[model samples]
Structure formats: structure tokens, C-alpha cells
Target: MTTPAAPARRVPEAVHRRRWVILGVLMLSLLIVVLDNSILNVAIKTISTPAPTGLGATQSELEWAINSYTLVFAGLLFTAGLLGDRLGRKKVLIGGLAVFGIGSALAAFSGSPAELIGFRAVMGLGAAFVMPATLAVLMNVFERDEQPKAIGIWTGGVGLAIAIGPITGGVLLDHFWWGSVFLVNVPIVLFAVALMLWLVPDSRDPKPGRIDPLGVVLSVTGLVLLVYGIIKGGRLADFTDATVLSTVGAGLAVLAVFVVVEKRSDHPSIDVTYFRSKVFSAAIAAVALVFFALMGVTFFAVFYIQSVRGYSPLDTGLLLLPLAATQMIFAPRARLLVDRFGHRATTTGGLVMLAATLAAFALLDADTPIWFLEVVFFLMGTGMAHVMTPVSVVIMQALPREKAGSASALSNTFRQVGGALGIAVLGSVLSAAYRTDIEDELGLLPPGARHAAGESIEATLAAADRLGARGEALVGEAGDAFLHAMHVTALWGAGVAVAGAIVTALFLPGRTPASEGGDRNQELAPAAER
Candidate 1:
């Protein structure tokens, strides 16, 4: 008569209380990191305009201001996770906050576009450190039963950040100089740093292995080159140009080699086998595409609301509230829909809604009712709520407990990569279409003015303002051309959403009642051992 095994003991009550407090701090840190990713959106116009009011930056330079941060953040995420594992996560987190604060302060005082871009990259470095450390610390503190709930809260913070960032930035831009956008981060960073030091516990892998130096080099180099090539191809170079072709080809080749190298490494930074699971692959793809659609729409829509519709920065941010508000409201409830309809149904349905919304946006013009855009924005945000949160839960379930930090970083990296690509490809299409439509209208202007106007919508608007009554007529023409370009770009975004929907439906595994419990392990296992 063998006795039944004793039930596992629960974490101590004191530890449990501490863990919840720590989680709150983690959420605060995550909120700041995620908010910085998008806070620049509503301020783009102010930052790039001619001096006295702005830096007088070029269009490509403006793109770099945003892309440089995302690119570096995405590129270093995995490597930074490994470093956090090897070093103390709390140490890394505190250090990251300091770096971010310093970068923000420096950015506020930047005199040139180059200085701002460089400081932005520094902030990205700090973000890379902060992001993985927060998740890793959360995983360490929470019990298995608690982790999923914790992750839900953490994911909800991202939605909240998205909801708040633009409006906050818009308000600041209304009253303050463009540099105030970066400056706002300084105080928040200080608060997070203080709270984190007091409440967060230090954690790291006791048996952390050697850092994969080659993997670090390859991932950073490959992603930077690929993104640079795509942006250049869209804005500055033809697809067939030697610089574009060679850079893109080189990036692809290096990434392929990186995959091969990782597969063979005894202690790889990213385990290639994770992608073998359909849940992981499909979830990653769906989330990435969701971000792709979101960023692509924002890339053009912000300009439309500002330049064409003549809304102020504050009003443009308010116009976007429907999208952010719907997303924030729906995010916490996403899991219920997943359980009711299953992952495949919920995710695919959301993608279809996104596609439909994008298609509707393609029909919009300068005079389309504001109410119509509000409806579209709400639907788009709702669809994203379904796609992002559910897929994140699926991914969290798919990863082993020990790999939490790396897996979280991986998910965010793909999302950032997708966003960067969307901007590049869609921005390129908009540029090409706008150039064709605007050139005919610009024939009446002097060559210098024509060249400047052809470069960007902002430039065209500025040129129009200089020409008095003729400029007003030119503004009308420019708006028309911009609307046409926007329509075509919206169609392209719709196609991407459709593809995501089809992929989610066909490739993601169907959910069953038992399968959900069976998918996750009951105990932690080190990824290196696996």
C-alpha cells in the first residue's frame, strides 16, 4: 500500500504579497518602455519642420529618428536578455533606467537631427535592457498558476501605453517645444527607478552559460541591414539599385547563416526548435502582422489628419483615441473570447475585421465624415485587441518557464521588425504614388520649389504657404494627390491583414479543452538542458 504523494506546497504569504508589489513596479517600467516606442508619432511634424520651430530634417532623416530606436531595440533584445540572465536582472533594470534617463535628458538638448537620432539609439539600448529584465523578473517571482494572470496584466499595460502615449505627447507638443516629448521621459524614469530599487527582487540564472558572441553579431548586423535596405529602397533607391539589392541580399544571407549557426550551437541564444511548434510560429506571425497593420495605418493616417484635414497635433491625437481606447478596453477580455471561440476562431476573426477596416479606409477621402473615421478606428483597435493579447497568451503557454525572458524578447522583436517593414514598404508606395500625382500639379511652380514640394507632403504644404493664393490652390492639389496615395497604401495594408487571417486560420492548431492544460509544463525546466 503505497501512500499518495503529498501535494506541492504554496509560496509563503509574505513572498506572495511581495510578488504582487513587484509586479506593479514591473508594469510601471514596462509602461514607460512601451510608451517611448510610440510617443514620437504625434510630434513628428514638429520635429522635422524648418528651424526656429524644428530641426529642418529631411524625410529620410525623419524616418531614421523613429526607425533607429526600433531597429536597435529589436536587434539587441535577445542578446540583452541573455545578459540579464547572466547578470542580475535587478542590476540590469536599474542600470537601464539610469541610461534611459540620461539619454532622455541629452535628447531634450540636442541641436541637430543627428544628435537626436544618436540619443534615441541610446534610449533604445536602455529599453532593450529594461524590457527583458522586467519579464524575467516577473516569471521568477510568480508561481505557475499566477504567471498567466501576471502576463495578462503585463500585456494590458502595453495596450494602456499605446492608448496614452500619443495623447500625452500631443498635449505636450501643444504647450511645449518638440524636445519636450523626450523630456517627459526623464521624470517617469526617475520614478520607475526609485520604485524598482525598493520593491523588485534580484534574479538571474544560476548556471548561465557562455554568451553567443557570433549570434549577437549576426542578429544585430542582419536586422539593421535588412531594415536599412528596405527603408532606402522605398524612399531613396529603386529596388534594382545595386546598393538596395546588395544590402538586402546580404542581410538575408547573414540571417540564414545565423539560423544555421544557432541550430548547431551547444548553447544558442535562441533555440531554433521553438518555431517547430505550430502555436509558437502562428502566434508570432499573427502578432507581427497585427503590428505591421497598426504601424502602417498610423504612418499615413497621422499625415492625413494633420496635413490634409488641417487638424492640430492635439486634435489628431484625439482622433486616434477611438483606436487606442477600443484596444485598451478589449485587451483584458481577450482570453474569454479565446476560450469561448477557440484561438483559431478568435484570432482569425480579428484579422478579418482588420482587413475589412483597412479596405474601408481605402475608400476614404479628404471630405469623408469624421464620424466615419472614428468608426473605422474603433473597429481596427477591437480587431487588434483580439489578435495581440490572445496570441501573446498562446506564446507564453508555448515557451518553457526557463525561456520566458528570451521568448518575450523574441515576440517583441518580431513585432518591431514587422512595424519597421510596414512603414518602409507602405511609405515607399505612398512616396511613389504621391510623386506621380503631385509632379503634374507642380509643373507651374519654380524648379527649386517643385523639387522641395515633391520630397514630402510637409514640404509641399510649406511651399504652398509661401506662394500666397497660388499656394492655396497648390495645397488643394497636393491634398488630392495625398488622398490618392493614401487609398492605394490602405489597399496594400488590407492585403497584409488578409494574408495574416488566412495564415492564422490554416496554420494555427485548433484548440480543445484538454489541449490547453496539456500544452504547458507543470514544472520549470532549463532551456539549455532541453
Candidate 2:
């Protein structure tokens, strides 16, 4: 007689207990991803020296090298989350690290601009896989009470990457070739892959569902076009006159279709119902805006300090230390503040400080002191600390346990998307404004002199001939013009933050944790009674 086979054994308790050990492994690996981004910022000077391409490669291409990885990352992450849920997060997570390491190796060996750009896109695909699985696994390993602290510890990697990228890049460039930056990821990924196999308990969702592949296609395409349109992409990437308008319109239509499809699907990947939570919605909006403004500063600050203020890469890194150094305290500690003060009060207060900082920055000049800039930005980072954890806790607490993976995926999606678009939007805005200001300032001189002054920013900056007399006067006017444009961007950023504050105040429930916990416990009572 055939006997029924024993049920498959689950992971042993010892194996399960070893799970948190993977966090340290993953942090070092993920830091490579984050560090690759800002690391290049400081090394811009060094990289340009050895390029085979003509000097001052088009602005769009420069933007691409930095943004391509993030765009792919933001674009593919939702799909990646679904993949993890359906197949297995552990499998995807390790695979992602492998892919990312390969891309980094390619980037390090890149011989031309095209090769570098291609490698960056490959890295993005790898990142697409890495991010979602990391969080989902962390949530899996820790209990609800313990999860936030785990996430906080995990987020500390971001702080470490941000503070250290420039410093590390500066030091590396001082010693080795620019490629050394990309090569650094190799060892970290190797170590993490080994640790992951040993310490991470591989698990998948016990209950699985269909993932809408068509919906994912539509969503990713739509985001690409939306990002392209906002950035005003050059025709070189196939953004021809016809393609630009048509691609943009098609993108919007596809996104609308995605929403409709998701609403109709029996097993939709994105939880359309989550929009009902005002707290979740408001907190997400805040995350997007804050990252947008923060990236704006980071994207251009290195260029401005080096190009205008004549700072070295090391000096630029040193200047940013304040933002990163003070922020580590804010990342985890801010949760306690959020618990004490309402999300509405802390969020509002934080945004106000961000607004004030940006507005104050509108007054900077060619002769403006670095110490002043440093002081203002230090306050900016300090205040932002108050906003981050509170918004995060609100979102996490509201999510049903079953849907937490999807929910956090969506929140992080907005953060990365906002960051990518912010670079494009803010950069384009500054370029247009700079051109206008230069033209008007040059109008004060003779027609011949006007053309010279109205030339591209490089031409004007390199024209040391303008340092005194008429040129000096024009420089002064140009500085004021730049400041004025920055003021408008700052105001836009502030307005978004203020809108978030209002939304939070309106939608958030006022119950204390004790009451909320009691309510949750009550909900569980009915099932137990059954």
C-alpha cells in the first residue's frame, strides 16, 4: 500500500534566525548601487580629461550617464516586485546582484561614451531587480514591531553611501583612473553573494497570483516617455520632432490604459485600492517632492562648486559632509519624533525649513561665501530628518501585512521617479533661464560684445576677458539672474511640500498607538471567535 508522503519540511528555526544577518550583506552590496551615482559627480573633472569625444559633450549625454541607471531602476522596479512575489524574492535578489556586478565590470572597462552609456542601462536593469527584493526580504525577516527598526538600520546604508560617495570618489581619482569608481562595486558584490547564500533563508509567498505582464509593459513605457518629455530629450535618442509629441501622447494614453487594466484585473500587480488611504497618499507625495528638491541640489551643486566657485573634488565632497553627516541621526531617530509629534505637525515644520533654505539660496552670488551656503544646507538636512521616518512609519503602519511588499514598492518607486525627473526638470529650467539672463545682460554692451556674452555658459565662464570693467558688470547681472530663476524653482518645491502638509493634516487619523493597536487587536477577535 502506498503511504501518503510527509509534507515538505519548512526552513529550520536556526536557518530562519540567521536571516537578519543578510541585512549587513545586502547593505554593502546596495551601497555600491547608491555610491555609483554620486561618486561620478565628484569625478566629472577627472573623467572629462581622458575622453576621446570632443570637449563639452552635449548636455543631454552628460545627463544620460547619470540618469539612465535611475530611469531603468524606477521603470522596472514594480515589475521586479511582482516577480519576487510570484517566483521568489531570494532568487531574484541574488540574480540582481550578479547582473549588477557584471554591469559594473563592463562600465569599468568602457572605452567610449557609448560603451559607458550602454553599461549604465545594463546596471539599471540589475538595480530594477535589487531594490524591491531587499525590502520585501527585510519585512519577511522581522516581526511588525521589529520591522521599522530593521528598515531604519537598512536605510542607514543610504546615509553612508551619500556621505561617503564623494569622499571615496575624490580619494580614488586622486590615486587611480576614473574607471576605478565603477570597479569598486566588484568586490562588494562578490562578498554579498557569498553571504546571501549562507545566511539568507530563501522564501517565496506561500500564496501566489498572476502578474499582469501587459500592464507592466504599459507602465514602464509610459514612464519612459513622461521622463523624456519633461527632460526635453535630444533627437539623438530617437526623440525626433514627430516622435517627441507622439511618444508623449502615446505614453499618457498607455498609462491611462494601465490604470483601467489594473482596476479590471482579478490579480492586479499594483493595488489600486490603496489610494483610499489619505495618509499613504499624502506621505508619498511628500517623499516625491522632497527627493526632487534634494536631487536638484545634488545634481548641480558639484558642477556649480567646481565650475563657478573653483573648488576641488575633495573640497566639494567636504562641503556636502554636513548634509550626509547630520542626516544619519535623522534617518532612524526621526521615527521617535514622529511618534511624539503628529505627522502633520512634524511634516509641516520640516517643509517650512526646506522652503526657507531654498528661498535663502536665491540670494547667492559669484562672491557669496561658502560658509553661508554650508550653514543654510546644514539646517535643510536637519529639518528633512524630521520628515522622513514619520512619513515612512505612517505608510507602513497603514498597510495590510499581505500587501506590504507592493505598498513599499510603490512608495520607493515614487522616490526614485521623482529624483530622475527632478534632475531633468531642474536642469532644463536652469539652462533656459541662464540663456535668457545672459542675453539680457549682454544687451548692455555693443552688438559684437553682445554675441560674445550671449554665447553658451562655457564660453562666458571661460571668457576671463570679461572679469573686469564691462565684463565684470555683466557677470554681476548674470549672477542675479541665476538667483532669480533658482527662486522660482525653490518656490515650486516649497509649494509641493506645503501641499503635502495640508493633505496629511486632513487625512491622517489622530489615534495614539495604544488605541490603534487595540483596534487592530479587535479586528483579529472576530476571526478568533469563528
Candidate 3:
């Protein structure tokens, strides 16, 4: 009699060993992309430590360093995916690695904020090409049947990159300069270029139609204005400020026009009607909400670590280990969970977990021990890992095989939108909280101390350290208030997560996982299908 154990054992035995090698190549390539994200956060203070080009850079420049890459990559994703289909995935992927390498080189030696932002934008452009290509190439290489396992591994790699980046960045910055963060990417990209050249096959959409240039213009402009207003909201007095409102309005209008252009294009950058498909739309929506909450936690948590909690760069990164680790550990399990629970249920549950995790984060305080935060961070990461990988699967499975690139691009675009809005919405909440509290305290102080009070949490802390007087401890009081405001912001983040959970739960179907052994849907979300 054949037992279940034999089938399980035979399945592993039949698996092509060479696929793991290809996976190794894919993982390294992807690691360079995601690692660039968290590593920069670690390098922020270190990079601006001494002020290389002139004197210390303005706070806006600091914001640009991170946002420049995020905005460009998000904006250009659709075009990059289309270009890959036109040019060939492997060729574009290889070229992107080279371009990314060059951008990293430039970033490593950038003398000014302008140079840094420009190079980072170049990096973003490279990343846009790389992101879609990685999944598409993997989709092409793995047969219809073997995709879920491969994707799970691939998603795990993303989680690993995320988890390890801060620690790696911290270690690098300790031994080398902040430039080391960018410098690190050079070797990795070089390695990826070589590995991809040797291992990956050249593939693209076979009968691709026209390329949409106008759509590209509109999407880029829209994302830039949207993200700019978001990141810069704190420096401004009003959200309704004419420039901010106008920029956001133009962005939306351009994107609206772009949508019309694509729907009519012989070769549309994206299939606008994909929203009509339940799986595709639901998958993207879930990711959008999930990442929205994640950004709120990650972005401001970093601020909390360095400014309010007073952790050093290395310490802050180490503190984030739980966050990354949670994502990594759960990514592989996400596939099995989804396999059993079905897509809608799995994703919705993930959303609930994410919301709960963020709600837990709201309980953290200046006096909260790091150990407690570590556990909470781990839970947050686990929930997020599940939410991301699974939803990605649903989107991929719902689309035509030839349309994976464009489908992936749109899914990612939603993620960027969610992240940008999270930053804007949650960040604005924090700013208002911070400004109001500080202003209230400053009103009691003499005019001389008001400027110091109006400064950021970091500046206030620096001032408090230098002041050393009991009566004139304006900076100290401001620092406390800063921590308080950040705490309130965490509550706002939790609220966003709750909203996301409800939306996901409401729309996502509660079906039992279908036993489509070699289903294309499973292949769609590379990480989630695992």
C-alpha cells in the first residue's frame, strides 16, 4: 500500500536540483533591490553626520534621500515593465543591474543633496526595471506545476533581505562611512549581473503591441507630486496649502488622463480593466492597505528609535531584527496557510493580524523595554509577510500568463500609493500633534527659546544635550513632547491598520482553497503562493 509519506518523499526527490541554483541567483538579484530600502534608513544619520558637501543639509534634503528612490521607482514601474516586455526581460534585467551599479557608484561619492537625489533617482529607475523582471523571469523559468514552491522561496528571500538590511547597514556604517551603504550595492549588483547572465533565459511578451509614452509621463508626474506633498507636509503649515493641493490635484488629473490613454492604446502599459477581475483587484487592494500600515510602523518607528528612544545606529538596526525576522519566518508558511485557508480568507486573516500588530505597537512608550518591542515587532513582521506574499499570488493567478509584467507593475503601484499615503496621512497626524504640543509649551517660554522649541525632535534633543541648565531646559521638555506626539502617531497608524483589516475582510471571498495542483494562480504571487 502506498502511504502519504512516500508521495511526499517522492515529490521532493523529483524536484530539479538545478532550480535551487536559479533560485539562489534570483534571491541575490532581489536582495540588492529590497536591501537598498532599509539600509538607507540606517545610513541616514551616519550620512548626514559630518555634512560633506557644504555644512549640514536641510531636513528636506534628508527626506529627499529616501523619497527620491521610492517615488521614482514607484512612478516608473509600469513603463519599466512594458520596456522589459519590448526589450527582453533578461537583457533589461542585466542592463538594469549595470545602471543600478553605476547609480550606486555615483551615490557613494555624491557631494551634495542634489547629486544624491539624482543618483538615487537613477537607482530608482534601475530598480523599476528589476522588480518586474525578477518575478516574470521566475514565472517563465518554473513550469506551471513547480511555481508555488519556487515563489515561496523567492518571497522568503525578500523577507530575509528586509530583516538583515538594517543590521548589515549598521555594521557597514560602523566600519566604513555612510557611503558604504551605497558602496555595498556595487559588489552585489556586479554579482547579480554575472549570475543572471549565466543562469537566466532571455524572455519577454512574444506578441507585444504599442508602447505608451504619454501614460508614462502622466504616472510619473502624478506620483512625484503626490509623494512630494506627503513627505513635505510636515514643513508646511497647511495640507490645503495651494501648492500642495495643486500638485496633488494635477497628479490625480494626469493619472486620470493616463488611464484613458492606456485603455485606448493598442499596446496599453496596463490593462485598465483588470480592476473588474475580482482576484487582481482584491490582491492589489489588500497589499495597498497592508503596506500602508507597515509604512506607518516602520517609518516613524525609526524616528522613535533614534530620536525619542536614543538608540544608536547599530542599536536601532538591531532593534528592528524582530520586524524583519517576522516577515522572513512567515513568508514560507504563507503559502501553506493560503493553500489550506483559500486566498480570500488567508489574506483577510493576514490583514487582521497586521492590524492587531500595529494596535500592539501603539502601546509602546519611551519607558517600554526593547525586549517587549522586539516581540511586538516580530508579530508585526509575521502578519505583514503573510499579507504581502499571498495577495501577490492572487493578482498573478487572476491575470493572463502574458500579462504578468503589467499586472505586477500595477500591484506594485498600489503598494507605492499606499506607502506614500501612509507616510502623508500618519506623518501629518504626527506633525500636527508635535507642533501643537511644542507650540503650547513654547508660548510659556520667552521668545529666545521658542525657535529651539519649534525645531524637530532630533534638533531639540541635540539642544537639550548641549544646554545643561535646569531652568532653560526647553529642549528637554520639547523632546518629551516629541516622544508623546510620536506615541499618538502610533495610535493613528493602528487606526489605519484597523481600517485596512475591515476593508480586506469585507471584500475578500471566504472560500476554501481550491486544490488546483498546478494552478496558474499559485504562480502569480511568487512569494505568496509558497
Candidate 4:
């Protein structure tokens, strides 16, 4: 005879009552972090312009400004997640918000590109704590049955940030200095901190593991080295350079050592064994690959819309509305698709759709209709919404509720690292391609200026402006070269998305009776229990 059915999992009365409110607070926290990145997308062109009006940042320096934040954020996330689980999520969240606000202020007043990059790293440090803590807190407040829906709404917050950030940045850039985009975070942070203290409850792991300082150091060092190598390769347009090869090799070596150390440690920063579960591994991989493709494409798209197409910052922000709008519309409803079609089918379909849209970029030229881009952005958002929500549910639910911080950290770590690599690698590809096509035309410029002019479309235009009427042919050639580079980069992004679709289809779980009940806790369960 079977034993009596186990009692249903219990969520505390206070938590149950205020779960939605807590989610709202968490979303507010998430909004500021995500909003900063989206706003920066529209401002990339402006940041590259000459001084007084802009920073006159080179393409590589601009990449560093972006990558510096991403690298630090990705590297510190696992440690921050552990801290949230051990020290208390509410404390970590409040502290993170404060730090982020401070960083934003510092970033706003940065005097140069170098200062901006440093300040952005400070922002990333705070964000590392903020992102995982938000998800970990949500997992605690909501019960298993309601998690997917809660997570869907939570993911939709990203859509909302995407919607608001560019438009807000556009208005500020139109009326005020570039610093206004960053300064705007201060008031919002103040409001979120007050709401969080009043409405959110503190939570932590009942049995927390020791902090692995060595692992943290290794991870950060490796990522920084790796990303630096990639960016350097792009700057020189030569991956075969000794510096690039040596740094990249060393980074891989350090990361390999990190994995080995984590495997042997008693209180590891990351439980390497959790990756044995094919479903868990696949979901994490999918997150990484998708972000890699998307972030890289986005880095180029901003320049395309502004520099190549001659659109104002305000127009670029308005044009991007369809991407964010579609995500807001589809993200909350994505769980319905998962329920009907299961994770594998839904995610696979989404990846295919994403790949198709990336490939569609190859069809775009300087003269491509704006409406075509709107359609592509709409479909791209729809695809992203479907992929993100279902996989998030899978990854979060795979481990016990108490380990939510680790789970969330693992998911976000891969996503951020993927985006960082995408921007570096794909940005490099675009740079290399454009440099090759534009180098010949640079003969019109002075000897020293030719090298600078070939760096990017913006640089070429800046050089053209200095040359007056004689630069007209160079201007036309620069636009054509950039389009070719963009097309090449788009295809590379599409190929990466297709690889993600394959991994999702092959390894992510199909529909199962216990899918919503957290399924089998095969790999992540404690050793004693296992």
C-alpha cells in the first residue's frame, strides 16, 4: 500500500498576502539596473562624438565602457548570490541599491571615458548583488505552483525597463547633457529603497555554505582577462596577435582551474555537480547563447540606426518601441504557451524565431524601410519573451527553494557572461569587417588621421566633418562599408541563435506530470538526501 500523500508545501500568511507587493518592489529594483543598460544603447553614438558635446570615445573605449560594467557584474554575481543567501536578501538588496545610486552619481560626473568606465564598474558591482537577490526573494515569497506566473511578471519588468529607458534617455539627451541619463537613477533609487524597507521581508538559507573567496577571485580574474583579450583582438583587428592569444589562453587556463577547484571544495561557490542534470545544463546554456547573440546585435544596431540612418536620438528611441512593446505584451502570457506546449517546444520555437529575425538583418541596407525594422524588432521581442520566461522557471525550480539565490545567480551569470562575450566578440567582428572595407578609402585623409578614421562609422564621419566638401565620397563609402559589416555580424548572430535552438530542443525537458511540482531534484539535492 502507498503511504499517505505528503502535505502541500506551505507559504507563510504574511508572505502570501504581500507576495505581489514584494514582487512590485523587486521589479522596481530590477528596473533601475536594466534601464541603465537600455538607455546606454541609444546613447552610444552620442558618447562617441567629439568633446564639449560628447566624450569623443573610440569604439574600443566605448566597448570597454559597456564591457567593464558587464564583466564586473557577471564575475561578482555568484558571490553576491551566496551573500544574499547567507547574510539576508533584504539587507543585500537595500545595500546594493544604495551602492548603485552612488555609482550612478559618480558615473554622471565622470570627466572622461576612462572615468566613465571605472564608474560603470562600480555600478556593475552593485548590480551583481541586486539582480540575484531580487529573484531569490521572489522564490521565497511565492509557492511552487505560482512561481512560473510570478516569474513571468518578473521577467516582464525587464520589458517595462526596456520600454522606459530609451525614451527617457532620448528626452534627457535632447534637452540636457549626456550625464542626465545616469543622474535620473538617483530619485528612483531613493523611492525603491523606501518601498523595499517598508514592504519586503528578509530571508536567507537555513543552512548556508561557507564563502569561497578563492573561487570568487579566480572567476573575476579569468573573466576580466578573457574579455580584455577579446576587446583587444577587435581593436587591433587581429586575433592572431600574441597579446590576444596569450591573454585568451591564460583566461581559459584560469577558468579551468576554477572549475577544478570548485569540484574539490567542500563549500564550493558553485555546485559543479548540478550541471550533471541535462535539463539544468541545457537551460543555462540556452540563456548564455541567446544573450550572446542578442547583445552583440544590439551593440551594432544602435550605430546603424543613428550614425548610418541619420536618425536623431529621439527618433532612435521611438523606433525601438516595438521591441520593448512586444516583450511587454508577450512576456506575461509566455507561461500559457509553456503550459500548453511544454518548455522544449516553446523554447525551441522561440529560438528559431529569434534566429530568423537575426538573419533578417542581412536583408537590411541603408535604404531598407523603417517599417521592416519595426517588424523585425517586434518579432525579436516576441521570441525573447517566450525563451526567457520558460527557461527561467526551469532553472529556478530545479533546486530547492532555499537555494534560490544560487539558482538565480547561476542563471544570470551565464546570461551576463554571454552578453559580455557577444559584445566583445561580435563587436570585434564588426570592427574588423568595417576596418577592412573602409581602410582603402582612408587614403583621402592625412596619414595619422587615416588610422583613427577607419576605427568606426562615427570616427569616419568625424574625420569627414574635418575635411569639409572633399569628404563626401568617403562619407558614402563609410555607410556602405558599415552596412556590409552589419550584415556579416547579423549572420554570425543568427548562427549562434540556431546553435541555442538545437541545444534547447535536444536537452531541455519535455512536458511531464511533475514539471510544475519542481520535477525530480536529481542533481542539486544535498548529498545526505541523495
Identify the leading candidate in terms of TM-score.
Answer: 4
Give the per-residue lDDT of model 2 (tens digit) for 18-105: 6567677667666877888868778665554434422232344556666777777876777777777767887888888899999999
Ranking by lDDT: 4, 1, 3, 2
Cα error of candidate 1 at position 418, Å: 1.3
lDDT of 4 by residue, 1-530 (tens): 99999666567887789899999999999999999999999998998999888899999999999988898898889889999999999999999999999999999988999999999999999999999999999999998778889999999999999988889889999999998889999999999999998999999998977889999899988988898898888777789999999999999999999999999999887888888777888899999998999899999999999988999888888888888888888988998888787889999999999999999999999989999999999999999999999889889878888989999999999999999999999999999899989999998888988888898999999999888999988899999999999999999999999999999999986765555435343333442123
Candidate 3: count the clashes.
6
Q: Give the TM-score of candidate 4.
A: 0.96
Q: Clashes in model 1: which pairs?
A: none
Off by over 4 Å in 2: 1-20, 44-55, 233-247, 439-487, 511-530
Error of 1 at 222 (Å): 2.1
C-alpha TM-scores of all predictions: 0.93, 0.84, 0.89, 0.96
Candidate 1 regions exceeding 4 Å error are 1-12, 514-530
lDDT, candidate 1, at 225: 83
lDDT of 3 by residue, 1-530 (tens): 86556323212232344567777887888899889888877666555443551224334555666667877788778788777777898888898788888899999888877888889989988888888888877766666556666777778887889888999988987677677788899989988898887876677788664677777777778777776775455655357778878777777787788788877887666666667555566677777777677765676687778766778778888989888887788887788887777666777777777777676766776778888888888888888877877777666566555666776677777886677667666666666567667776555445786554454555454445455564256656665776777778777777776776666667654554366534545443443322
Distance (Å) between predicted and true CA of 460, model 4?
A: 0.8
lDDT for model 4: 0.90
Relative to the unseen true structure, what is the C-alpha lDDT of residue 387 in candidate 2, on a scale of 0 to 100? 68
Check candidate 2 and list the clashing pairs.
none
Tell me how far the alpha carbon of residue 337 in candidate 1 is from the true structure, in angstroms, after superposition. 1.3
Residue-wise lDDT of candidate 1 within 1-530, one digit each (tens)?
99999656344456567897888899889888877756788878887688878887766677777777777777777777778878888998899888888888888888999998899889888888888889888887887766666776777777788778888888988898988988999999999999987878777777665678898789878877887787677664266778988999999899999899999998776777777766678888998888887887888888889888889888888888888888778877887777677778989999999999988878788889999999999999899888887787677656565666777777888887788778777777777678778888887678876765776788787777777787778888888998998999899999999999998998765555745544433311222134
